[model samples]
Target chain A: MTLTGEFFAFMSLALVAVIGGVLLLNLTKVIHMVVALVFTFVSIAGIYVLLSAEFVAVVQVMIYSGAITIIMLFGIMLTRHHGEEAEPKGGGLRKLLLFLGVLGFGAAVYLGIYDLNFEAVPNTLHENNTEQIGISLYSQYIIPFELTSVILLVALVGAIVLARKDDEKEGDKE
Target chain B: MSSVPVSAFLALALILFCIGLYGALTKRNTVIVLISIELMLNAVNINLVTFSKYGVNPSITGQVFALFAIAVAAAEAAVGLAILIALYRNRRTVNIDEMNQLKN
Candidate 1:
């Protein structure tokens, strides 16, 4: 409850994340939202570090902040959006209803979970976290790990198939 | 090392989730809505890691789940954006409200 260095670090990171998320929601420009999203993802990586999940933290930064942000930028560019009004605004009543829906869901979850007290386990990873994660992933969870790769392959193929323009139209015209 | 309480992270995830939910629900732009969905997934990652650290059985399983979630999220974003680009090529706009061709 009292102030400590951990508390300060967590507070600052959490504040940055919340602010970034808020800005992402309210920002009028797509590029601004992507930047805010990067800020939020980086803050989440910091939180993962705080939780002692170093491997997850690294993956978060690499995948979420680095790969995902760049891909989104590419998407925006390829889609050919023009000028500053790229982000369209929602209607007032719809916005109010959406806000209320989110508020209600958050309140319900908080009310359900607030009463339960959680005891913090001291140092979940006794050895190297990356080693432990690798061992577990390769040994016990190998099926899912391989399945994930397959999923990625499928996604790659799907994206290429969907995004590539068909050449049949030119052939048919000839 | 004075440990931070589990409730703090939980609260943070809650706020992030709600913000994401609001954006995903109300945003007119398809790309922003996709970004909002990523936000919600990140909130779930925070919760999973928090529980893995603080839970009674504390193990690497939750972290592993988070890893899978992240991979899946990346794939989802890639595919979603690809689809969005395809739609844009045909429709020339990214507004979700105007894409009412399926309403017939």
Candidate 2:
């Protein structure tokens, strides 16, 4: 409500994030779009810090902005893009309709959250944020944490299998 | 953003999610579609962390949930990109509509 440093920080970060998303949508070059999204990802990290989730903010920086963006760029490089994605002529009508639909959905959600105020409870999440996450993750969330590792392993194996060149198929091609 | 209302954070998430949804639905490129999905997930993370700080029962749980979400999202992106590469190799195209075949 009142002018505060936190308010300015949030405003600037959110503005950059929104601008990055807009650029991602509007950019013609596929690589440029992904690059634009780095701004979004980093600003989201700033937002995370503003929300008093320092550990999550660091993770957002490391994982989302760092790792995921690199993987996306790799994905883009591996695939052959024709500069811009070709939208067929006359699909503008459908795009416009989709835009309107998305706008309507956003408006509906906005109305629900516009007056949604929660009384701020004092939480110890900020003090030793990383240690809090570690304790909780190793204690109450141990099972899910173990499950995540398993999931990552499965995804790793599956990706290799899917992306590996088919020797027999190549032989068949010859 | 201690002074900023919870609604503002929620609104930011909502806007990002909408942008992501629209991009995913309309983009022809498979990579961009996947990126859009990641953006949607990021928006969800914002909501989770927001509620963690400002909810009726604020605690560390919401942030823990967000960590799990990030892990899952990373795995999903890896698999999705792998699938995209494989599809590109077989089909020689990256457009989503062109990938509408079980067997050629």
Candidate 3:
């Protein structure tokens, strides 16, 4: 592949994304880790744009980078005073083993895809991309779309119920 | 633009997935574990969108699937945070290792 602008874009985005993930892994402070992940999520959105998925890219920015990260911070804030992720005795050994296992898993998967190629069929997904997704969601995927709304509602109610302070339990504890 | 091979995208996803896996498995903080899981899901979304564009059957279906995945992930985050809050209320700690009430 000749060095083109697209290649450069993909390269830079992927580098930033990888660095973000690495920082998330290595960062000591949980809040700092969350901040690092914003970079990864945003870079992935850029990757989506490179793949001609403008609508999905925008959604990724809104949902993952914006909504979910904020929700996580809220979770952390409510929980309060979580010190550094302290490693237990012999935990360093466990972490090393896990890292090796993950590396092996990644290598195995990479071996399968390192030579992956497909016939380049020029398609018009880039043009009116949002329109295509909307049409598909409404027509072919109408049922699942509606079901997603139902699931979201259920999750909303369930979260409220699960998180509500129980006066009787509080009385018992007191 | 087409010069960037499908494998490059696939490799990126794989690397991210491995990082997520390692983080989820090793991190003791419950919220960070949840965050790592989110990273794993994000990696899968990348793979889905990549295949949507460059796979044998290039269609808009993959993008639709990615959208649904995003919705489900959002719901998951909400519920997970709620559960974390409740767990912290009872246990007063966010360490995954120490919250083993069910281990007995």
Tens digits of lDDT, candidate 1, A35-89: 9889999999999998889999999999999999999888877776653434345
Candidate 1 regions exceeding 4 Å error are A85-90, A167-174
lDDT per residue, candidate 3, A1-174, as tens digits? 999999999999999999999999999988999999999999999999999999999999999999999999998887776457676668877887888899899989998999999999888899999999999999999999999999999999999998986646888889
Say which candidate scores most in DockQ.
3
Error of 3 at B93 (Å): 0.1
lDDT of each: 0.87, 0.92, 0.93
RMSD of each: 1.9, 1.5, 1.4
Question: Per-residue CA lDDT of candidate 2, range A78-125, in tens?
Answer: 888888878756888999999999999999889889999876677887
CAPRI quality of model 2: high
For model 3, the stretches where C-alpha displacement exceeds 4 angstroms are A165-168, A171-174
lDDT (Cα, 0-100) at A16 in candidate 2: 97
